[model samples]
Target chain A: MSQTVTKKLMLFFPKCECEKPIIYHLVKDHNLIVNIYRAKVTPEEEGYLVLDVTGTEQDIQRAMDFVRTFNVTINTTGKGVTWDEHRCTHCGQCLPRCPTKALHFADQATRQVVFDEAECIECLACIRVCPFNACASAF
Target chain B: MKTYEQINDRIESGKAVVLTADEIMDYVDKKGVAAAAQEVDVVTTATFGPMCSSGCFLNFGHSKPKIRMSEAWVEDVLVYAGIAAVDVYLGATQLRHGDPANMYYPGEFRYGGGHVIEDLVAGKTLQLFALSYGTDEYPRREIRTYFTIHDLNQAIMVNPRNCYQNYNVAVNDSDRTIYTYLGILEPGRKNATYCSAGQLSPLLNDPYYETIGVGTRVWLAGAQGHVYAEGTQHAGDCERTGNGVPMEGAGTLALTADMKQMRPEFVRGVSLRGYGVSLALGVGVPIPILNEEVLQRTCVRDRDILAPVVDYSVDYPQKTGRVIRYANYEELRSGEIEIEGKKVAVGSLSSYCKALEIANRLADEIRRGEFLVSRPIAPLPRHAKMKPLVIREK
Candidate 1:
């Protein structure tokens, strides 16, 4: 049986390659479900597209190859955490629980908690202790 | 000196000066307490934290050939139906029936009464299952139905205890990790968890309950409520600092509000791993600056409030009440604090920013004459101490 995986990818396009329809090729050609979290790309100017593409392991690889034919830059953002801002209450309960303090208050005045994926050691402590289930781990 | 009536009159005329407990700290520093008392009409204080002794009473309209529920549950979580034929009380900490609580793993505690209450307030529909022994007037033995808060005749949030004047800073002195309601405690005091709004706490602003008592109107979960009674275990005679603030948990308020009107954001359901479920409540109380002495009390700062550090793995379980050290919010919120010449990381269970937001929101209402400040009909009991339970052999 084939396994399915959801991977976040960052695609950078030159102004000339912006008309290539990369999103259309991802869904129609490879039969992938892409959730575009952020899109700065336009038809006239160079920008980036950050999305979570879900499909079988092989299909995602084929989509990457198809995207590379356009000479666009690609970077895998890792199977890290997808923080749902709506679910987070900013209570700061996940701070001391994280061994590396990956989830700390952005500042004292606002007290908005921000997650630094670089500091997260895949310990899964945030997923274990979060009362609101705001943080999700792919692994 | 000003009277509560005078302050209210000024509020209605759009001439009242309102400030949050957080905002008053700077004002007092710049203009002094006497000046603040003369300028400010009310000081709003708030706390958003877990209070286990919280629950709501709901009255379901009588059904056709009603079952008169003797046992009932809302979305698998049990509700106490002993009150009346159609009334039930859903406790915040009540866990769902047959939940795998530590039997398989260290318990996930996904769904519970608290979650149900939040869903109810959010206008989500839920399944209600009930059973009863049929009576002459009520003939049905079972009922399975879908309902929401709109289906109820009345829904009231009645919390026996809501705000803690001060609280413990939980740490682990043992060599192994442990799970508690305060959150996970790492071994050897590697990390700590403290739950309180510190200076913004309602009772902390009024420490002695001078103006806060039965019949005092308050802001509860984004709606208006009242301090109906003295909360359980309200230790009014606890140890205090030179400024009269309690050094430990003291002065609590029994609050009540219409659960239907409460906003879902303020009435959140929280689950602590290895511990059961609980509700995080938002409550705010307005203190009228009737005199300089009252105004001075509300001018507290985070650096001035203190909490005792205790070992959750041993002392707390054994009720030894051993205090490792005392740390204030200033040191705790610094992200790291030193104890015995070693640095220990700290986290807060209470939302400090949310408390400030609630205080400011209530202050806006007062300034706009939307929320009125009221005087207490009577003062809270003085020198009320909590007693320990004992086992008796007959």
Candidate 2:
């Protein structure tokens, strides 16, 4: 039984090295699913790619290791979404925008909204809905 | 009915039991209005919403040659310095240099005067520039310097208007989403945006403006403040409900508070998408329940406080039959409300969390004897009327 999990990964590519097919090697060699959440790839200097890497525990580890062999730095950040509590006013304005109910009001007495990242599908609904832009990708 | 003096005495003697507006209804329901009126000495009401009519007056002590500052800017945002030589009034809604109105394109209002005030209060060094014509006695012409809020001799937020009694509910009847200070209301009544804390709002609870008046002690941005005057647009002469609460916009409060004691959490700079910037203010007012009528009034619920749902797509200042429907905050806060036929999602610009927090904090302060309730020096006018301006041949 293969257990699959989603994770946020940042892949840094070296300058003037656009020809390197780093993602191809991870999928073909390591058999990992790569979903680019955000990317800044260009024909210029250093570039960064925020990705949702999904596969079995062993294969995902090997995929990250395989990318490192190509001189690509990888940093595993967070699961679904990360909320900056300081920036969040807990306005609860984004509560209705959440389809998955991952973002919810924690206390009826206080009406303060709390985020459960595990339930967040990484659909970026909270990011677009938040008035304060407090919810952001963990990567 | 007990007088305001008797209520203050009860508060001082620790015989006053304080409850938030949200908590008052249940207490009254259990103990009955008559018993609760005698038992509950105060009902603390609060609201945390974007109030655009917010700013501060800063007194920059003095410079070398005592230049009269004709023009002053804090963090690239210009402040009105016409009042005094060294004093400046920085409004929260003032835009930065060359910011497009973006009525059609609708870009984010990234930063403005509100953010500058927040940064200053956060102890961040702000780039300040002032220009003045060189006077014979005061030789200095201009100065570009850096100063924090602490560097200023006085930083007082004397908002001409802060707490609005009631506001219109915003809805978009058009096909596209319209950005406004009322928060974003989606197209075709897809969503509704309301900006009051319902029962917890001070003006909503004290609908008739009985307890809330001039010199009323309030919890302002986490600091002790007072209602100083009638607000700029005090529409006292409006259609009222049977309970004496105005059906539309009504009384407003001019608030004054010291900037030194304010908390950053309570005061936030809000960017209202396409509209502009506004200060997300947290204000809490404690009403001393002097009689059964006061207790009953404080027991008003979210469903009882009604506001007209207005379509924002209507042209400038023209009421093109924009009021589609009337809905209370209870229906608005229920995630969705039935408008025409579609189930419209509802959003509130008011931070109910922060409002509750302020109310609770103030209650705690009162319980600890750190805060005291004060009587209003003057009651609000009962017959004030708002007149519209029109062009005429002078």
Candidate 3:
């Protein structure tokens, strides 16, 4: 019997000019191999995108790195972790410190930080440096 | 209404009040004046999963033993007590309703979810309080106890002689140390026969443990047992690897088709939530108070358990501009450490290490009479809330 393999990746974007298309782009670019899923985004709250990327690790990483070029905030799940946005000031203090550049400053009007889930290595360097105490990880 | 000052006076004067669950209900029904009160700490135990050596072998891994907490009160009280290293058990109903990210156990699909508070409260244990300490600055110190479901139930159902002696040893040992053994549930007992006596019989009945005879065994082999065995065996292989290894090796490996079928049972079914408490007492205090101090101290007397023994060349950053290293836990414990080539006063080590230190500090604080057992008599708001909730709510 054939088995279906799937991987769910959750991406949180503080701000995004283009919304639904981003999901479409990821799927189309990845040849629909990945099942792109979106997380619920709240207003005034930072925008987050959860991508359920179903494909090979390399393919997933390729798609993830592709998303990183946009320079937004992102995070992956299932490694036992949770992030607190309340402590975040969106001062862009952690953007430079991110080794993978998984975080980007949002549009000034939006006061959001883009989280590139694909680029996040879960090293938690951003969490370590965030003075506002907004980041947390679990194992 | 009594002021905070009056409440503090009453508490200090030993005239402080403690209300049971029933009394609290009466007070609420009568619309009585909400006064400062405290909760009496109750300890209970809970059983966990199939007996396996998964969690005990390694310092960290997915297959390790776990317990989860589902109820809000238990989570709040456990957190308020500054305790970590607890296993939160989420039942199936809870997972479906709560959509909790951490519901990673199988039985969670049926029963209501809850958490395992080791050394605090055991299985099905509940404590309703009107007042209790809820502050990080001054955390409450209470005599919390925990037990497992198997032990608690066995104590209630099984006669003392019928139960195994190992149960006592296990419970006593867990009570004395940071570690607790979560009992396993085994299905398909062979040759077990139940017999009941008269109503006035002092002993209820005994389950005669035996094996089936040849004729019965032949019939059983053809029965559902074969299918059950095959399914269980397949599940076991999937949960473990093809070779029956618990976790995948740390590397890139492709999952075969057979492995895919078992993914949900392997990945999603085993939800293990750990709870930790920060005792104001020093890090090592609980060891002694728990009566494992002498053993642990003796064990580590000649050797350093927390010594930095990782291969520095391999573990250290290859492209290092400024590297900060500590000699041992002592240096980190002292709070002064060189970070990135500068003398920086460190409040604590990494979060992992900080949890250990905080737990120790809290334990010590309790020992020093600096902290008292206080619960929230009235539902406190965020500002009045003691410690920030660490675990996120879904």
Candidate 4:
């Protein structure tokens, strides 16, 4: 078995399994270390949880496969970032807020702001500074 | 020495050579100021930044009964009333009535007076409403309807203050980030942002106001405009560096331009997070190189224009002795600088790229004889002093 690895993920539970205590099973049965950063759950509706899970590579893969048996969707990506072209004024307001150089002016002549998703640390600083609410994230 | 008339004649005949402040520096460095003065007829300077005092006057066509508007709103943002019966001045910083009042974590300012003005200039129809007390002659109490910039009798942007000569650099020392009109300032001096475009700025190059004054034509928001008066908060008297540029805020311009000719690219709406709404305006002024002294003044470079970084977390004008020391625009634009043993990143409120575009475009207009240069009807006063307010115990 490989060494323990940590991964941040988002788990979505459909309405059919909203009442099931999947987190309890992950902790007791699987013996996985989990830290829930955010959770939104309702008795009769879909639910979501953002968590950091730590376990052996094989154990983590098995745990995710087991989650699929409950009809729950798991995404290992931390968060999703999207830019609304219609709303963004290309004013470059969010350029400085980004700690990483993921966002910058495209070139000298156009001076339009562009975002490179690969370089983004997903700190959401751009979302806060954007005056037009152009930068949005899915958590 | 070239006279204003001679320069005007040259411009009219398409013979006057124009260069940007940066280009002028190269010309002057290659040949001395005297020779450059003989070769270059004009040097252009420009700045593009958020100017809060920007606004426009709109004359809504007379209603059935002209209402002396006591209260006015454009797209839910309040505008200045008490002007003429039908005229209203829409200020850029005015927030909508529905906007959140929170200062720290206030949400985005999606739309406001600035957007409304921009929409009007773009030939879009906007809702205009006004309430007033009914009178004998003008008995209309309230009016609400859509008004386009074309339908309005007149639309003119007469900003009380536009271009600032040299502004301070903003930095934060607190543990938490602070959102200010200067933009988002990171905590622990992680970043520093300055406003002016340094040597490319018009007023900074003409530090003493020798050539720029009332009636001087400038490239305002991609349109031709003229300086009307000395701007509000005009600080002619201030400490200066050896180069004669003010170490603090100094001269400003009260400008006026027709709204019909403005381009949207040059007019941008900005929201300073916690602060309020403002308009990013592009302005370019041409300096006629009449003598070698004027040419030398216009040749100042980014390395020589120094500005002090100030802590904006505290109350301003009262937070004395908070300056970290002066840094030139060249250092500030380097993206990171060591200050007090810490590496602090840098940002800018003024767009150097846009300023360069405006300067080049203005030079092109002059070279093609499409734009006319005007002499100032009256020179700006040089002895004016800015005084600080003191709170005295009663």
Candidate 5:
């Protein structure tokens, strides 16, 4: 039985590394599903891609090792989505906009929209959908 | 049966038994309605949501040269300056000059009169520009100045229509998604959006504006206010149940409060992505326990209130009034409702937590002898029909 795992990651590409088809190699070679929420890979410019890489645990590890050869940096920090708790009114207006239940009510009692960074794929849907501007993009 | 004067006496003496609409249900469930009625003197209800009919009337202290302002713009958003020389009515949903509304297709609608209201209340400096066609008494033709909340003589929030008895559950059944004042509705009934506080709502508790009427003191955005009149388009004679709860948008109130005493957090500026800007304000009405019948009505549970599910993409906009189904607050709060045997998610635009906070605050104020409930000198209309407008050649 293959153990499937999905990792939320930010891949920082150096100026010299943007030319390579790194995402293509991950899909064609490692057979991973890369759902890119945001990408800024430009020629001669340092860029980053906030994405979700899903595949078997073994294949994802192999893909990470392959990307290391290009002098690219991999970070697991959830800094892409900026949410201010003070501004959140807990109206649940951002419920349907979220692909995942990243922003959802903690429980029926309080009915507050709590932020779960682990579940966030950096889709940034809650940023603009929130009428209160409680959610924003850090980038 | 108790009287409004009796309740006020109890409030003044610090002997009143005050509870929130949500809290009253527990009391009634424990002690029964008849017993609870004699013990509980008041029940406070509240709702906080986007009310587009809300706005503020401001009187800017006259300028040095004095200009009879015909046109005024605050933070690039136009304000109705026809009231007087320095007075302006800043509507909540008014867009900025050259807003390019929906031209961007799902426009961000970043700034508007709503944001300006929030900024002013937050004590931020705002630029005001006025134009006049040169008057003799007020000789200035144009003037540009900056002012803050303190600079204005008066900033009063006057909402012409607010606190609908009930609202529809918006759904989009079309192939494409639609953006509306109700928020974003997903295509093919993927999700539903509702905008009411349900059982804790003021009109739902009172049913027929029994205690919430003209001259009735209310908690308006953290300050005291009064119900001045019936709200615009108030269709009080809507479909109802045996419990007297309106099944659709019904009785409403025109409320006013001095914005100087209001907190900025209670009056928030909201920006719907594709739709225009609107203000989300907090309003709480105290329903005095005049009799056992009043106590029983205030004990309305979430299951008792039903909201009609209307498709915003077609039914609502086309005025066909097609209802897919009726779901109570219980089902809506459960986060899912069955549509065509498929479980579709649901959400609400109103903040139940904020409403609860306001209700609790009002209850505390009444308990501490700081707030008192009063009967209306003039009752709201019980049978007012909303009229539709049609273009005609007179």
Candidate 6:
């Protein structure tokens, strides 16, 4: 029997003020798992959050493309990327940027983008091309 | 203005006037006292916690051992009063000479830690004063002298007070004798236990120089602010005395007694500030100002007088650790000798030795002078015309 290895991915969001339930729903609706950590806040800088995830490389890439459909920025470290709301414009231009066809627009009533942390491969291709500067990596 | 040489000559001839407490008061009461007091730049106060009575007992696994404790005595008080500068001096000296191992441990044991003269001298330029007291048929005369360094580059005068009084004076080495001064500030009863000195953790462990997480309460009293801390002792607790007198249920008695001893006249006006240390690093030495220029130019680094001399090491914890120690004779002499490297000859080893000897003799001479009567007041004069001025401009 062959053993399968899963890569760990981490994501960070700087200065997030949204309630925990809303953040959980944004991730759960997309079937993604993430662990949150807080960063030290200095006088000159804003607060930030970090998330760790584990998934296959292909699944991670698929997840990155999927989160982009809702206009949420994403960057991957290991296999996951952060989505910052401050820089997010909710523009759907990045939906066509993902090659895996994982992203799709959600209901207009909900202003959140669906994200699967498990499906991020940390390729950083979508992050580099992100014009909003909302996406960042743990690294 | 007298030159340094003239002052040195007067001190050498035993012609320097020893200012009595009354004379000091009178001098200050005069118009020029502030200017005279300005000559005093450095005032070093060091608190020496009693040595651990259990010598090497903990190292040998003797956990619970009874130790004979000595009377907690105030070691020495160093004051840089005037005449440019003089070395620190003490009236009484007690020297314990024996095998270091038997006292501290086996083998050659050096008194390495708990002397912080360098830290005390960090920003101040002052001479080291060594004073010793003596008693004989000619009269109980305290001798004053100075130090003159020899080729050894360092001379450790063990218990300079005891050496001069008992050993040096007996050998008629008065010329080489260190000067002595009667204590202006006398040792009082050990009345208060602010907290056990042992309770203080080493300085390095404390990040903020504050005690952390220990539910110790501190009482801080400020002139413009209300009392910061107050508490009651447990009932039935007894107050311990320096003379071994113990009184039961003496709540707040310890502080009251200490206040009474420290200032008997104005006990009511004395205020106190106390706080608990989650981590205590002992008391800090106030920075010495060698001159007005030095006072104005010097900057505070790490809330200490001297900058870090060398990096902290476990062996040399005073330098490395947060806690600074008092400087011994050996350390001061070494520092004086090292000054030669800077191309400054304040005095030779013999000269230094003589300075201390002369200081001790001067102290004795001052003590022998006729005591003056009458209390002296501050020199600041109140002028009739020096009323509050109010100006009205059209």
> Candidate 6's residue-wise lDDT over B1-394, tens digit each?
2333443344455554443111232343463444643543221111111111101000001112211111111112222222111122111111212313324311221111111121111222222222323223222222222221221122111110000100000001122211111000011210101111010111111111122111211110100111111112212222222221111111110110111111111101100111000100111111122233322222111112111111122212232222222211222222121221331111101112112222233234323431111111221111112122367797
lDDT of 5 by residue, B1-394 (tens): 9999999999999999988898888878899887898899999999999999999999998787889999999999999998778999999999999999899989888889888988888889999999998788899989998999998999998999989889999999999978988888878898898999999999999897777788999999988999999999888888998899999999888999999888888888989979999999899999999999888899899999999999999888889978998999999988889987988888789999889989998899999999888789899999998888888999
Docking class of 5: medium
Could you tell which candidate, 2 or 4, scores higher by lDDT? 4
Best-to-worst DockQ order: 5, 2, 1, 4, 3, 6
lDDT of 1 by residue, B90-179 (tens): 999999999988786568788788888889899899998999999999899999999988989998999998788899999999998888
Q: What docking class should model 1 receive? A: medium
The TM-score values for the models, in the order shown, are 0.86, 0.92, 0.21, 0.84, 0.92, 0.17
Per-prediction DockQ comes to 0.50, 0.58, 0.02, 0.23, 0.64, 0.00
> lDDT tens string, model 6, A40-82?
3333444343455444445445666664453444444443366
Which of the numbered candidates is closest to the native, going by highest lDDT?
Answer: 5
Q: Write model 4 residue lDDT over A15-113, tens digit each, in one string.
A: 888888888888887778998756878878888887778988877888888899999998886465667765555555567678787888777344556
Question: Which pairs of residues collide in candidate 2?
Answer: none
Q: Please give the range of 10 consecutive residues that has the lowest summed lDDT in model 3 chain B.
A: B200-209
> In candidate 1, which residue ranges exceed 4 Å CA deviation?
A1-79, A99-102, A116-122
Per-chain TM-score, chain A, candidate 5:
0.79
Each model's fraction of native contacts: 0.69, 0.58, 0.00, 0.21, 0.77, 0.00
Worst 10 residues of 3 chain A by lDDT: A87-96
Which digits, one per residue and each the tens of the lDDT, describe model 4 over residues B1-394? 9999999899999999999986888878888877788988889999888888999998887888678888999899999888878889999988888898455365567677777777777788889889999898888999999978888888899999889888898888888988788878878888887888788899889999999999999999888999999998888887788888888778899999998888876777777777878887889999999898888899888888888778887735356756777888878766666788888877677778778888999999999988877889988778788766687998
Judging by DockQ, tell me the better candidate of 4 and 6: 4
The models' CA-based lDDT, in order, is 0.87, 0.80, 0.27, 0.83, 0.89, 0.24
Report model 6's TM-score to 2 decimal places. Answer: 0.17
What candidate 4 gets wrong by more than 4 Å, as runs, is: A1-93, A105-113, A131-139, B103-107, B315-317, B390-394
